[model samples]
Target: MLFQVGGQGTRPTFFEMAAAQQLPASLRAALTYSIGVLALRRPFLHKVLDYEDEFFALLMMILEGHSLRTTDASFSESLYGLRRRAVKIAVNKDNTQMDSGDRLRLSGLEKHQKVLSVAFLVVLPYFKSKLHSIYNKQREAALQATLWGNDDASFGDVDYFDGGETSVARRGLLDPEASNWTRIRKRIEAIIGVCYPWLHAGNEGMTFAYQLLYLLDATGFYSPGLHALGIHVCRATEQELMDTSSRIARIRSRERERLRGPPWLKALQRVLLSCIYTTLDYAQTGLIAAVFFFKMMEWWYQSAEERMSAPTVYPPPPPPPPPKVAKEGIPLPPDRTICPLCSQKRANPSVVVVSGFVFCYTCIFKYISQYKRCPVTLIPATVDQIRRLFHDM
Candidate 1:
């Protein structure tokens, strides 16, 4: 009798179990006969069957003392071949199987065939593709998040998607997993480690080519003293530095020649070379700016300290103060000719002799500091020269 459930026959094959447990050793011995007989007669149903249910039914019958006698050798072989093919198809179609939660009761032959079909076609392939996609997506998301920042709006909303939490719970896209600060720090450290040697080796050609624009200030370069100082500082290790740079270049050339080989070998060499070059370039530019700025700050500090410490010498005797004029005798200029400094009618007006422009003494003094000449006529006048002219007036 076939396996029974609640007094009704049920499919005996279990997809999760090994073939030995689902079908007896006696049936295994007759597999060749049964397989052959089944194929020749084409005894199975050909409809769009629920294959897993059908597999369970056939497996149940085989287990329930249904034997293929050896006398019928070809018939047994056909049956065995049909069983194997059915199992393969069943396992491969595992993804389409109703979830365990949705499975329904089956009876006798139907139950047996369903289980065999699922094991051979459904369950196996389903897990393979599912696991593959899961890991592949995780790896891809990690790479994207590493290059570009996080994508999630919030971890709070991760569980709302229809396909369930698995979609967003994956760590790669999350903020905690994709830290830009950490990556930047690692990159900075790698750059410093790669470029420090070239800088320390005092490779002047490379250093000057890379650092010249940054070393001197734009305005200071116009001054002959400052320009000479900058050039002298840069040429400190002239001959020896040049020789060292030449040797390093020769070494790099020889290394490149030695590395040239087969396509794959050369490709690997170029990738490594490119990474080092890029890293070094970033390091050199940043480090040069930092070093030059620090040196300027140091020079400023030393100059300030020396000036503060230097002795102050007495100058020649101070000049006598100018005599004050009587305010009543001074004529006030018209309101339209207001003083530039105080923005009031010019009291005690004085004609700027160079331009014949009249203004308060205070206004003319303030204007002369900025222009060193009359604002109207553009005639040159020093403060002393203007003071002498005013005294004579």
Candidate 2:
């Protein structure tokens, strides 16, 4: 309705407007998740988290205020090459409305328009959220009364009430479910439900109507907030959005030409300017891409496979229990010729090199082969370390 006639130069596409809105929503979701994680580590952050809506409103006010002050655009709008301006309506000689051609050439938003636009952008969402939260709590309370009120109120049994004064008892049964809080909530809902539909319907109907208008000639704003505030987003012209670096380059160029600097210096300046322009152009897109990449990496690292494959450190096994060593060799009887291992007269005597203990050939051979240690001193001895001894009978 504000611009019934033809639109101004190059209106932004519907997708661009939608993308701008999505950026802030995505950022809010990410911030909420991050703050929840931080709340566990810092006790004071719990208070910040408790008043999340207010905290976010303050943050948006700062960001949007700075952006509008500098560039006449909100943070997201400026990123997408758009800026806000108040709608300019004019009357013709016959008191009929004129076309919007001249209106497009208007300078900027008026003082009241700026204040109202920012307030609507920040406050509308908070108001809507509080309304929905109240509705949810009321619904939950009503459900709890229906499900558990009888037990909570110390009723003996429904069957006991069925026999005596059926109508009176049935009425009393319903009484417990409608506590003072529930009755008050019901009354308030009834009052609002009767009177609020007209305003709510008008707002929604206007929003839909504006979308239709946008399709016709991109006349009205795409965002409901801007539409309600009597403002629209327009494609910012080059002159309006001149780069500061470009201005600096122009001044430097005049100096260079005046002084006749070296050719290489001019070429180097051109390259640096080009680099700066490219970085500024891609900065928003790159930031969004980087955020998604980090989220993807976080998801991948949290997967079950990553957890199972994670390495764990363990202490080394204790050194093999000192091998049960005996200081003296195996005890021998008065007869020095007895075999200590088999406890019998020595035959085919053998000596172990590791512990210098003597035993029967078969006994020492089997013991060294099976256990790989001396039977007397428990020293490490192998089958190859055994030697057969020869003596005269």
Which candidate gets the maximum lDDT versus the true structure? 2
Question: How do the predictions measure up, each by TM-score?
Answer: 0.15, 0.50
Return the top candidate by TM-score.
2
Evaluate residue 319 in candidate 1 and report its C-alpha lDDT on the 0 to 100 scale: 66
By summed lDDT, the worst window of 10 consecutive residues in model 2 runs over 1-10
Clash totals, every prediction: 49, 0
User: For candidate 1, what is the total of clashing residue pairs?
Assistant: 49
TM-score of 1: 0.15
Superposed Cα deviation of residue 181, candidate 1 (Å) = 35
Residue 328 C-alpha lDDT in model 2 = 70
203 in model 1: Cα distance from truth in Å?
A: 31
* Residue 120 in model 2: lDDT: 73
